[model samples]
Target: MMQRRTLAAGVAAFSALWLAAPLATAAVETPDALVKRLSADILETIKADPELRNGNIARISQVVDNTVMPHVNFRRMTSAAVGPQWRQATPAQRERLQQEFKLMLIRTYAGALKQVSDQRVVVKPLRAAPEDKDVLVRTEVHGKGEPVQLDFRLENTDGKGWKIYNLNVLGVWMVETYRTQFAQELNKGGIDGLINALASRTIAADAKTAKSAQP
Candidate 1:
């Protein structure tokens, strides 16, 4: 369990790097190119900004908002994570879950980003066809010993460009992992119960943050 959590944390940390790459010159592209562009951009920003190297929460939040969220399809991710429950959810419940799930990820990822230090990413080229709308960009994150494989799955949008819908770390899909946990919670507590649980967790995290800020 600890190993799984660590892998997930690593994925969250790499997510910011996964979004900063430049797309291919071809009119049609693959996931590998997108991941490369996103990761490069993220590294560039951190390299240029010495303060962000410290992993301050505020700075991490800024990077997430500016460089991460814009390219992530949270709604789609949420739906996929929820699995079958997603189809059963009413529109309102779906919306609430989507919002809560996005917040949960942002908060979770923000916390993980604070743990990122001087880590270098090694991009491994993968074969992707032009017609492949959904592709996973595979890379190994090196530093602090034992490189871990990170994969970002992206889908091309009609006009908004490429957006990330899933991430795989060490052969585990982050959203899917959470979905299983969430589904168990829902089964036991129902949709409202799940929402309340997520809210409580967020509130608790916030309180912990506030307490840590004290002198």
Candidate 2:
């Protein structure tokens, strides 16, 4: 369970690096090229920024909100994580789920990305065809340890270009992992119960992150 949580944290952090791209280059760049460009760009920016490196949770959340949230199809991610219960969730419940999930990811991102050191992300050659709507972009984080495999599952929309909806971090699919957990919550407590549970976790996580970020 601890190991699973660790891998999920990797998903959260790398999801930020890959999704928090430099605005919308979606129209001009192909998905692989987009990943390549954004991965290097975000990492370099983090390496250069002192506050980001030091895990200022507020600053990290702000950066992620400004750069990461816009690019990701997080509504779809939340839907998938919620499984079939998503369709049954009322508008308010869905909205709450989205907000809590995003907050949890931002807090998770603070801890995960802070582990970045002298690492550089190298995107492997992409194999998908030009017109492919759904594709995977594979990459490896090369640094002190062995190269960690991180793959992105993305969808290309008409005007939205490419949006990441799922992440494969070290062989674990983030959405599926969360789906299993969320299903447990839904079974035990239903929609409101799930939302409340997510809210509680995110609040606790944020408080812990905030306490650790102190001087």
Candidate 3:
């Protein structure tokens, strides 16, 4: 409860992390180990950098690009959010959707990475078979109040290490939530409509970020 509000207000964005993994070569990073290390690194990076703590949009974008984007499985995340319409989308549209969605998240949460002073991530032991390719890792974010539950759904490729495609916070899965909204937009107009909606939100968020940055 308070953790969500605190994070949404301050912004660690485990929500964004669910969407934050991409192509990886052969690595032996286990899901829980990755979460523990990634979480620690992110917190340290934010607290150590003054500009990031101050919420400079440009700096935040740079950090996200260099640090987080590499680990995100963008296609799996975007396509799942787009639902069945994903297969119908052309390559260009798919690219646009992914771009806008990326911006929406960066603009929404990445910029606030600085306010993570008290939040500490505790990843629970992962439960899965040795042969499993897809698995969930449970975690908690401890802050001002009761610890909030966070979960990650990760998939592994033969050569690639674990990549996160979805995230859950406070009992809500981000993809499932976005899918419903995207479906509504799809019904109203189509893929274009959904893209437009995401674009509009991203644009508005950009404007808000700019204004905030203005001192």
Candidate 4:
């Protein structure tokens, strides 16, 4: 049962990777195009680097920093996910939470990337108005098993071009999941409490990684 659960987690992680692949191919012509282009670049690096295939946490972080962070709208996502608490937080607190949340996601997703193997993603055709500020790029992840839908929500920015704010895996929105969790945390301990919790979680995860690496 334990092994089965682990395998299930692995599959879920790979599904995310499968979903992210098409974002690389997104052309600058459209938001969807830019998403595809970015996703493709990240996945291409994963495919090219045999060391990254082993799923090292550090390697995954490097990939995210280099290819993914540049195109993500962390501030917008943090504010939206935290909802009203975002306004309550001091500028410093909000910045801290945003930074921690971003790192948490990168670390979490990086861990998942290790599980992806023998899977490929297919980007569905998208049509949206050029004037539209927000658009969803729909794609599918295919493996030896059934295909699952992955949707990426992107917003156009004057300074940064297209930036991703949300991702849907199998019809589940990642931002919504975080929102619910953050609300619960805030209710239990307030905004500072929630920030501390996220910071602690990151520390614990990093410690675990370090311990595992010790000879």
Candidate 5:
């Protein structure tokens, strides 16, 4: 299993990438175009904004929650990451899980967003038919190091358009990696155990932020 810190870093990089990809409602907007637009725009925005590149966690997370969450199917992501335990979760339990998981991810990635530099995202070709409800949009983040592969699996929900549910970073699916971690907790305790683990992580992350902001 991937270590929690490694997974957190990888997912944070993904969060920065996807924050660039809000859904475009234009009639001519294809997944490719949408990604292209967001990637370029987000890069430009970051390049011009010192706050985002300077480790401002509150502003970074605000940008993510306000601009990126709308294009994400986080409920689907949280449920899928929980695997079969999702079906067994009570509605309230599921909500708490999603809330805690979202908090953990956003905060973890908030610091990572400062690492965004001259990296450029290149969207790969789309292989899906026009009528396809689901699609995989591949891309690579090229910077100083070898290009890191970052891809998104998006589903065209009824009226929501294309919303991301999964991400592949360096060939590892985000949800799958978390699924293994979550499964371990589930096996040791149960759904509540898993939820508690997520909650604890979020709280710890918040505490770290609180400490950093202290004198």
Candidate 6:
């Protein structure tokens, strides 16, 4: 269980790097090219920014809200993570769930903003044809440790271009991993319970951040 959590954390840390990208690019680059460009741009930005490297939550949160959240398909991610209960959720409940899930990821991003270092991403050649709506961009993160396999699942929107909805790190799919963990909580206390549980986690993380900022 600890190993699983550790892997998940590592995934979150890397995911934060991509989430730091600018909301949109002027050119509609291929998915592989997009990932490669953002990986280098975001890492270099973090490396140069002292505040971001120091884990300044406000700064990190700003980057996430402006850059990360816009590119991510949060509603889809939240619905996938909640599994079957997602369809059952009322519109208000669905919105609440999305907010809570986004909050959790933003907090995770704050903790992980500093994790980007000399890591380099190498995107494998994309195999999809032009008409394909769904595609996978595969890559490996090579740096201070053994290379970690990272892959992204992006769906092309009608006009918005490719939007990231799922990511895999070291073979674990982010949504599936969360779904399994969320299922346990849902079975015990339902959607509200799950929301409350996520809220509690965000609250705890906030306290930890506040304490760390002290002298």
Cα TM-score per model = 0.80, 0.88, 0.88, 0.80, 0.85, 0.88
Of the two candidates 4 and 6, the one with more favorable lDDT, higher being better, is: 6
Candidate 5: list runs displaced more than 4 Å: 1-13, 21-24, 212-215
- lDDT winner among the candidates? 6
- Lowest summed lDDT across 10 adjacent residues in model 3 is found at 16-25
Lowest summed-lDDT stretch of 10 residues in model 4? 18-27
Q: What are the per-residue Cα lDDT tens digits for candidate 2 across 17-109?
A: 743547544255777877777777777777777787676767877777777765578999999999998999999999999988887776666
Task: Report RMSD for candidate 2.
Answer: 3.1
- Model 4 per-residue lDDT tens digits across residues 83-136: 898988899998899888977776565555555555555778876776788888
**In candidate 5, what are the lDDT values of residues 69-108, reduced to their tens digit?**
7778899999999999899999999999988888777776
Per-residue alpha-carbon lDDT of candidate 1 for residues 1-215, written as tens digits (9 for 90 to 100): 65755574466456456335343455544556666666656766666765565445566566566656666887898888877777878899988887677556656655455445565667787767766666677787765656777878888867446788887788888887988888888898877777777887778877877787789
Best-first order by TM-score: 6, 2, 3, 5, 4, 1
Give the lDDT of residue 172 in candidate 1: 80
> Which is the better candidate, 3 or 4, if ranked by lDDT?
3
Q: What alpha-carbon RMSD in Å does predicted model 4 have with respect to the real structure?
A: 4.1
Rank by lDDT (best first) = 6, 5, 2, 3, 1, 4
Q: Each candidate: what lDDT?
A: 0.68, 0.76, 0.75, 0.68, 0.77, 0.77
